[model samples]
Every structure is written in C-alpha cells, then in structure tokens.
Target: MTIKNSGKFIIQKEKLIIYLFVLSVVFADILGNGNLNLLYFFGLFLIFKNLKIQVSFLKDMVIFFVPFCLMILGEIFLSGNTFSPVKVLVYSLKILVCISLLSYTKKRFWVVDHLTIIKNICGLFEIMLVISLLTINKPIFWRLNDVINRFSKTRLKFLYSEPSVLGILCGLLVIILLYYIFDNKKNYMLLKEIVLLAVIILLTFSMSGIVYTAIGIIVLFLFQVFKNKEVIPRRMLTYFLLGICLLIIILSTNNPISNRFFSMFLGTDGSYNFRWSAAVNVFRKTMEITRYWGMGLGNMNTPSGLSFLLNIGIDYKFANSFLYFFTENGILGIIYTIYLFLICTYNCIKSSKNIRPLKVGVLAFAFVSQIAGGYYTDPILWIMYGIVCSNEKTVIN
Candidate 1:
C-alpha cells in the first residue's frame, strides 16, 4: 500500500484503539465489573501499535526490565518450577506492555482526555460513596451490588475470590479519587464526590488500598516540597503537619510495625498475622537450611503447584504474598521483584518531568504506594503507572 494509504489506515486504526480503551475503562471503572477485563486486548493493541520502537525509550525500559529479569531469576532460583523462567518472564512482560500502552496513549492524546472519562466514572462511584456514607451501613455501600449480584449468576463477577485483588482495585480507586482532590482541584460540588471516593476506599477494608492511599498522601506532600523549592514555606508547613500526624500513628501501634499498621483493620481473625508470620517462617526455614542465599527458582510450585501456594499465602493460611513469593523464590526473588518496582518508579519520574509537575508528582506518589508493598494485582495501580510512565516526557506547546 502507498504511504498515504498506510497513514490513513493507521489513523483509523488508532481511533478504533482509543475508542476501545474508553469502552474498557468504562466497563472496569463505572460498571465495576470484570467482564470488560478481557478488553485488555484493546489496551495491548493501543500500546504495541504506538510503541516508540526507537532507542529513545531504551533507558526508561531498561530500568523497567531489570527488576522483571531479577524477579524471574529469583523465582527460578527459589521455586525451580518447570516453567520458572518462562512464567517469570511472561509476568514481567505483561507489566511492561501496560507501561508501553499507557505512555503511547498519553502522547497521542490531551492531558485531560482520559482524565475526563475516568473522572466521570469515578464521579458515579463517588456519589455512591456519599450516599452510602450518609444513608447506609457505616457509609459502606457496594454500589454495584445489584449489578454484581446479577452478573454473578453467570461467570461474570465484580468482586473476585481473591482478597488481594480486591485490595488492589481499592487502591486504584483511592488514587483516582485523590487525583481529583489534589491534581484537578474539583470544586465544592465535586469535593463531596472525592470524599465519597475516600469513603468507598475505606469500605473496601483493603489493607493495600488504605496503605497505598496513606503513602500517596505522604508523597504528595513531599512532591510539593521538592517541586516548589522556591516556595518552601507553605510546602514545608504542610509537610510538618503530616509528619506530626504520622508520628502519632507510628507511636500508638501495638503489634509489630507492619502488622499493627497494615492488618489492624483486616479484622481480629489473626488471618493476616498468620499469613505474615508464615512468610517469616519460610525465610527462617531458608536461613536454617540454605547456608548461602535461600531456596532456588520455581521451588514454591512443589507437588501442590504454584497457584495453590499463592492462594495459601493470600488467605494467610501459610504465608503473606511478600514473604511467600520472596522466601520460597529466595534472595533473587526479592531483588527482582523490587527491581520491577524501581523500573516502574523511574519511568513515572521521567514522565512527570515532561508534563505538569503536579501530575508527575501525583503519579510518582502513586508509584511509591506500590513499592511500599502495596498489592501488585490492583488494576488501578498498573493503570496509574502506565499513564504516568508512558507520557513521562510529552512536549505540549
């Protein structure tokens, strides 16, 4: 085909890709159902199609791929699954794919483009949160309960069987709500909307959600201080206020630092504690057994298989996600896992510089939430990183 024909075809294809993304976002965000989760295809297409195949993005990608590589090695060295390397590599690749799509889409669109669609859906959720807060049980209403109930009759389910998954989704929602409050500065009318988002976040009873939000808030304060070094007084004043608040929480906890802070609200079942303790136990076992590092890759799979072990870890039946994945996966596991996180973090920072500092700051804060052991399964977490990293350096005149 001629260049003109190819160009026209590409333009049409791009439009379709963007439209698909909007559809997927609505399905996931507003509808609150995972039926559209399959629409990840559209997301993949948008990224791969527009991917900057040049080496310009090589440095950014290297930062991303490093952790992924290390995480795979750790998994292999510890678990030793038949598909250790492949499994680890594929998982890591998925993350990079999302990052690519996110950056590519942002470069091709306006700042507020996707923001508007997402905010609209969030607006609905926010309203539900407000209504629930004012009218229902402890302001904890699952707005999509009816939809979820109906959808559950078949295979479609909004709330997954996985607690961590729920936690991850809740984390994303909290970030979006904050994005409105901090970055967009929604008005008094919208303030209620954002407040509702906060309420919904709390209702999820998700440790990941709560922790990430808290961390994001802390980062936002720092972002302000660093970005506006010239106007340090105001930023520093806010920072000081936050510091005092955080100090109170830290000093008052009863359990171990991580447990007291993270699992208190996960309820008194001791489930959270049990899982975390198991992680420590695994590490302890490794310490006793392995004179050098720990278990090798693919060890966790065992006769039980990798999935079962993960489920066990999730319910706190055996271990927590961090300890189980790292310990059984071993020393390499921890390093690689952290590496993927760092790469994602680096990309977010790079993107922030190219756009409005505030947006970058908001995204950077979101990333910090993840690095601090916020759950990896959260779609919002990935979305936030993808959007921020992809456009880390867009030039808008």
Candidate 2:
C-alpha cells in the first residue's frame, strides 16, 4: 500500500511540475518575467534521467535530423573545429528533454482537468500581461527587456530580442483563445471570454498574431455557422461588441497597425532587418556548400552578414522559425514535420465526432493553433502535444 501510494505521489508531483514549467514559459515573455522555478529544474532532471532511444520517437526525431546531419557532417569535415552541428545538436537536446517529459507524464496529468488548470493559468497571466502592455507604447523592439533593464533583470524577453518574438507570442495566444472560442458553448460569457482573449493578443503588437487571429476568427465563425445550422445568433453579435471593446483597449495605441504589419514582412527595420538578412544568408551559403545535406545543426545560426553579397535570398528574415526548419532540415524534414501535424490534426478531428461537447471544443482549439502558427518551441509544443495525445485517453480514467 505504501509503494502504491508513493507512486501516485510521484505522478502527481511530476504533473504539477509540468504545469508549472509551461506557465513559466508562457509568462516568460511578459515584462519582468524571468526566474527559474524549482519545478523546471526538477522536472528537467527527471526527464533526462529517463531518456532512451525509443524506436518510434527516434524515427520521428531522426527524420528531421537528416538535414541537420548534413550540416553536422560539413562542419566536421571542413572546419574540423565544428562550431556548427554541435551547437544545433546541443540546442536540440533541450527540446528532446521536453518531448521526453511530455511523453513520460502522458498518463499522469488528467487531460480535461489539466486543461482547466491551463485555462486558469492563462487567466492569471492575462492580468499581468495586460498591465505590462498598458505601461508601454511604441514599437521600440525591446519593451519587455526595457521594462526589465530599467526595472528588473530577467532572461526571458526583457528587451524583446526581436519583434518576431512578440509576433510569435501573439500568434500563440491567439491560437489558445481560438481553441476556447470553438469549444465553449454559445453563451454571453463565452463570447466575452474570447473577445477578452483576443484583446490580450492585440496588446503584443505581433503582426503574426494579428494576421493569425484574423484567419482563425474567420474559420471559427464558419464552424459556428455550419455546426449550428444557418442562424446568426444574438450571442455572436454581443461577442463582436466585446471584441470591439477589447480591440479598443489593446490596439488604440499610437502604434499604427499598418506599420506593425509592415515590420513583420519587411523584418523589423534596422537591427531586426539586418540580423535576419544575415541569418538568411547563412541558409543560402549552406545550400551552396551542401545542397544535398545543407549545413546541418550548428549552422542554424548565421555566418554571413550580407544577403546582397550572397543573394540566395528572399525579402524577409531567413531564420523565421518555420522557414529555418525547412532551410536547415531540408525538404525531408519539412515533410515529416508536416506528416506529424496531419496525423495529430486528423486524430483531433476524428475524436471530436463521438465525444462530448467540451472534448469536441478542445479538439477544435488544437486545430486553429496549428493553422495560425506551426510552431515547434518547447512548453507550447510539448504541452500541446501532451494534451493532443491525451485526447485518446478516457475522460474518466
């Protein structure tokens, strides 16, 4: 009995650790948001200890590694010092730790229950996040860090490392909100909650978020129209009003919406533009050096500073998260990633069919997240993957 009880305690601790870590990452980008929780350290320690080369997991990770492999090989053969592959491989190892924990704690965290906790956590951050936005104005690029450098010192986003960083966060929040919007029942609170969520997203001034939110809302509105038979409900009208209020609160700043959108495409002028251009040049050079395998892992960051000198380029940053994967990993890696996405999405859609309303709602939420931002970051990726994987587990269990 003692042994059994101990097992349950450990499982609970593990799950709680995961929830804490995810919340940390989500809030990490917020102003003055940096500090390592005990949960992060302990959970990471446990995951690495249990690491094994599982066949299926290895196969999935390896498929993506092929492009990385080429880069690693080039770095090894030519430079000999190999500053390239090693750095990427080392960086990638962090994600492996996250993936392992997600897989390890798969059975521990109760899906719907944990999701409720997540919703609550978001509610908590919403307070701090909105407050942070209220204090800042203009597109200064490093608001979070400025909030930090002047006020506090933390690693996260203090002094926004990049505008895409904000864009990325906004994209993520929008996706999360869309999930709730789809799953929640047709009620005034639900409408208000969604608009409130969108308000939170707009505060970030992330072009990615703004563009993604628009697309996501369109899809969601269609789902509502189709799912409920061609009727325009009064609740939706009210929802729009709430959205307008939220918009005024979040977007009625000095920052022009068009300029913000322009920055996303043009690459935040000056520093961001120059840096991204350099990163893309690295991709171009990699293609020239090893079109077959490319520069691989360590070469993920750039070696070149000029796209004009080595114009294997496009208009935007070469290292945009999705673009980086395709450039570094190549067509094969991109294909496998796409495949995993399709499988999960298909399952979510399939699971929605025979489940209860809430479960169906959760599934819809996952779909919109993928559509708006095909991200592969930790916490966001692993935690979401865990929830998606848990869709198959029984609710009662």
Highest TM-score, which number?
2
| CA lDDT, every model vs. true structure | 0.49, 0.48
Worst 10 residues of 2 by lDDT: 148-157
lDDT tens digits, residue span 87-138, model 1: 4454555566555554554455353455455556565555544564565433
> Compared to the true structure, candidate 2 yields what TM-score?
0.62
Which residue pairs show backbone clashes in model 2?
Answer: 71-295, 71-296, 84-298, 85-298, 142-160, 144-159, 145-158, 145-159, 179-365, 183-361
**What's model 1's lDDT at 357?**
43
* Top of the candidates by lDDT: 1
- The C-alpha stretches of model 1 lying farther than 4 A from their native spots are 1-19, 22-43, 47-63, 66-112, 123-192, 230-269, 287-321, 341-379, 387-392, 395-397
All models, RMSD in angstroms: 7.7, 7.1
TM-score of each: 0.61, 0.62
